[model samples]
Structure formats: C-alpha cells, structure tokens
Target chain A: MIIKNSIEGSFHLTGGDFTNAGIASSELKSILTELGLDDNVIRRAAIATFEAEMNVIIHAIAGTIYYSIMPEHIKIIVNDMGPGIEDIELAMQEGYSTAPDWVREMGWGAGMGLPNMKKNSDEFKIDSVVGEGTTVEIIINIKQGLR
Target chain B: MNIHEIASKLSLDVKTTKGDLEREVTGCYISDLLSDVMANGKEGDIWITHQTHPNIVAVAILKNLSGVIITNKRVPEEDTLKRAEAEHLTIMTGQAPTFEIAGMLYHFLRC
Candidate 1:
C-alpha cells in the first residue's frame, strides 16, 4: 500500500487462478489491522473485498481492486472483464447464480456472493454491461455517519 | 476440548504442526458454501467442509477459526496444507460423511 493522505493501492486479479485467490484481500486486512482500524470495519472490508475478488476470479477474464483508506472510512472499487450481469436485480437476490458446474464443484458460485457483499458493506454500488464487464464499489465507514 | 484431544478421539489425520494442537475449539461450523461460512461462521469455531482448496484455509484465517476438518477422507491440496502450515492453522481429515463428523465435532465442542 502507498501511503500519503490515505493508504491506497490496486490489486490485479487473473480469472480462474485459485492458487492465489485470497492474497489481495488478506493483505488489505493486514494493513487495516496494523493501522488499528475498528475490528468490525476491518472484517466488513475483508469479507466484501473477498467476495468481489472471488467474482473476478470465478467469472472475469481480468479484474482490479482499487482501494483508499482514510481515518473515517475505507473505499474499494472492483472492476472486472466478464460476461456482465443481464439483470442486476435478479443477480442481487440471494440463491440466484449462473456459475457453471465447475465453479460449483469448488464450493463456490452459490448465489450468496452479491448478497453477502451487500450485507457486509456500508455503501455498495454496482454497474455492468451485458456483454462487457461489471464494476462494484464499496465503502465502510469507521465512524457512524449518514448513509 | 483441545484439537489434539479431539484428533485422537476422532482418529483424524492431522496435517499441520503441533503448535495449535492444544488450542481449544470454541465452536463448530459445518458448510460447503464458502460465502455462508464467511457470512456466519464465528471465530474459534472448528469448520467442517468437503472443500480441500487453499481458499478454505484463507476463510479459516479470516474468521480466526480454530481449524478445519476436511470430511469424507478428502485430502487437502498441497497448496492448502502449505498455507495452513505457514499460518500455524490446524487442519485434520476424517473419513465419515460431513454431517456425521460435524455432529461428532458439535458434541465435542458444545456438549
């Protein structure tokens, strides 16, 4: 992580690479822990980012997670190249997934990815094009504030 | 109960070092869905799953789980063992079905 006014950096993800799947999110969690952020905030960030990272790995050809941390909050933006969601509403519903059998065999691609991400993050925004890609942005505030 | 004691009683295949063998198991969580575990699993819980991937180790670490039980006699991948060893996380294997072992584990930890 590069530190100036905020701790910010980006991690690149390669699709179908399970060998190093959680490394990026793990590193982020470590940094937040060292910075002495609230434990809840750190956990929420870890879970949200991990779900996003797995999305890129399971579905995208490539993806990148860009994050910035300030004293009050942490922000993450995950962008991926994949067959983007055709219906965001349906995709966000729990127990809805289009992942193939291979992904299912690994104990992933259960329809809970999006719902879990949304459940953990304080602010979540997603946008996608049917044939191009998807982007997810998440922010978790350390201190209580307006939603 | 501690992991080592549990291992002996269950006849589990211990795959990691001894450092955490004496660590107490605080609870139990059984699931194959990674997201469900992430969303609901608690720290110090012993996880039981059919998944033998390294990411299972990652989730164990993320939740500060006591260890992971790979049920159905499925061996963990080499990478998974390496990761767990590096972190000093306990991992064991059992031949029984996931639910059966989970029941045994729940009895050990909760009863």
Candidate 2:
C-alpha cells in the first residue's frame, strides 16, 4: 500500500463490464486518499481517472491504470487494448461521440469524457493506434503541498 | 433540507430499502451527462436526471449525493435499484420532467 512508503500502483479494468466499471478509478481514489494528497488534487485526479476508466469500459477490451505519486504531482496512465480512436482531433471536440444510443442512455458517451479529463488535469496527453488501442496520461499538481 | 422531508413533500415513490432519507441535501444538480455532474456536482447534492442505468448509482456513490431522483416517473433498472439499496443511496421517482423537478427543488430549498 502507498500509505507504507509505496508510491505507485496499478488497477485492472475490463471492457463491457458495466457492473464494475468504476472499481478501478475508485481504487485509485482510495490510494490517493491514503497518500494524503490535497483534497483539490484528489478531486481532479478522481475526475480524470474516472473518465479514463469509462473510456476503457465503453470502448476497449481491457485496460489498466498506472498510478504514481511524487512530491509535486500525481500521474495516471490509462492503457487499454481495443479499437483505438480513428480521429483524435474529432474525439477531442466536446460534443462528438462515437458511442451508441444505449451508452448515451446510461448518462455517458456525451463526448465529454476526454474533455472532462483534460479540464481536470494540469497536463494531459493521448495516443492511439486505430486498430490497436489507446493510452491516456494525466497529471494533477498538488495545490497545497510541494516538496 | 433532508431527503425525507423532500420525498414526503413531493410524494415521491421511494424505491430502495431503508434508504436513510434523513441525510441532509445541501443542493441539487440537474444533468443527464455523467461527466458534467462529475465536474460540477457538489457533495450532498441530489441529482435529477432521466438516466436509469446502474451507473447512475455509481455516480451517486462517487459524488456522495444525498439521493437520486429519476424524473418523468422513470423507474430505474433493476440493477440500479439493487445497487442503490445495497449502497444505501436513496432512489426516488416523480411525475415531473427534469426542469420541473429542478424548479420544485429550488422552491423548496429557498423556503
């Protein structure tokens, strides 16, 4: 556990698993809380991690979130195995979504996933191969603590 | 206001088991977008939306919302009710649209 001098952890996510889509991000949130990060930073990280986890659950076959904590900031990398985005620029647009009506009825797939991730993150980067998979990296700086 | 007061006042159909309607609701957030709620919805806010999927319960849990109201009398999915019950998150339904429900809450909260 990170509470005992640990600085990084990874949580696995399964695609098409609506029953447990949020487990990974909540796990990440718990680790952040255990590490005693600033509340604001934890909230930002939680939003980004949750969006990343949802992207994987909605689009990928499987995924893993790599969490790392430094004295200055928290870094989260979500890597997934599935069909990647065909158009990064289009996907970044706030209202452009490829998800079906079923996902929309679930209150997600509003094309806000990536935008929300970027909005809550101090730094964000995304990479994907159309036939392969996608990876999202997000960083949230600690507002009240520095070392 | 507490959830019990609002539920009783509105005559809502409570759909969960012993959902502790006594929890204080600080505010209300009306949104059908999960990300929008995640970005802007405050803790202890009751969420009003047309979404009935189980993920709504997950969102309510993540945000620590006082309760969830599915407007237009839309009953949540079985899994949603089950999860809400298991999580002790209050799930209710009303015969109003999203805007009307929001309006009603504003009136009650302002009083």
Candidate 2 CAPRI assessment class: medium
**Model 2, runs deviating above 4 Å:** A1-6, A143-147
Model 1, B111: alpha-carbon shift in Å?
2.0
TM-score on 0 to 1 scale for chain A of candidate 2? 0.92
Q: What is the DockQ of each candidate?
A: 0.83, 0.72
Tens digits of per-residue lDDT, candidate 1, A1-147, equal 222377799999999998888889999999888877777888889999999999999999999999999756789999999999999999999999999998888888999999999999889999999889999999998765312
User: What is candidate 2's lDDT per residue for A31-113, written digit by digit as tens?
Assistant: 77776776677778887998999999999999999998876678899999989999999999998999889888787899999
Q: Give the range where candidate 2 chain A is weakest over 10 consecutive residues by summed lDDT.
A: A1-10
DockQ winner among the candidates?
1
Best by lDDT: 1
Off by over 4 Å in 1: A1-4, A144-147
- Looking at model 2, the pairs that clash are none
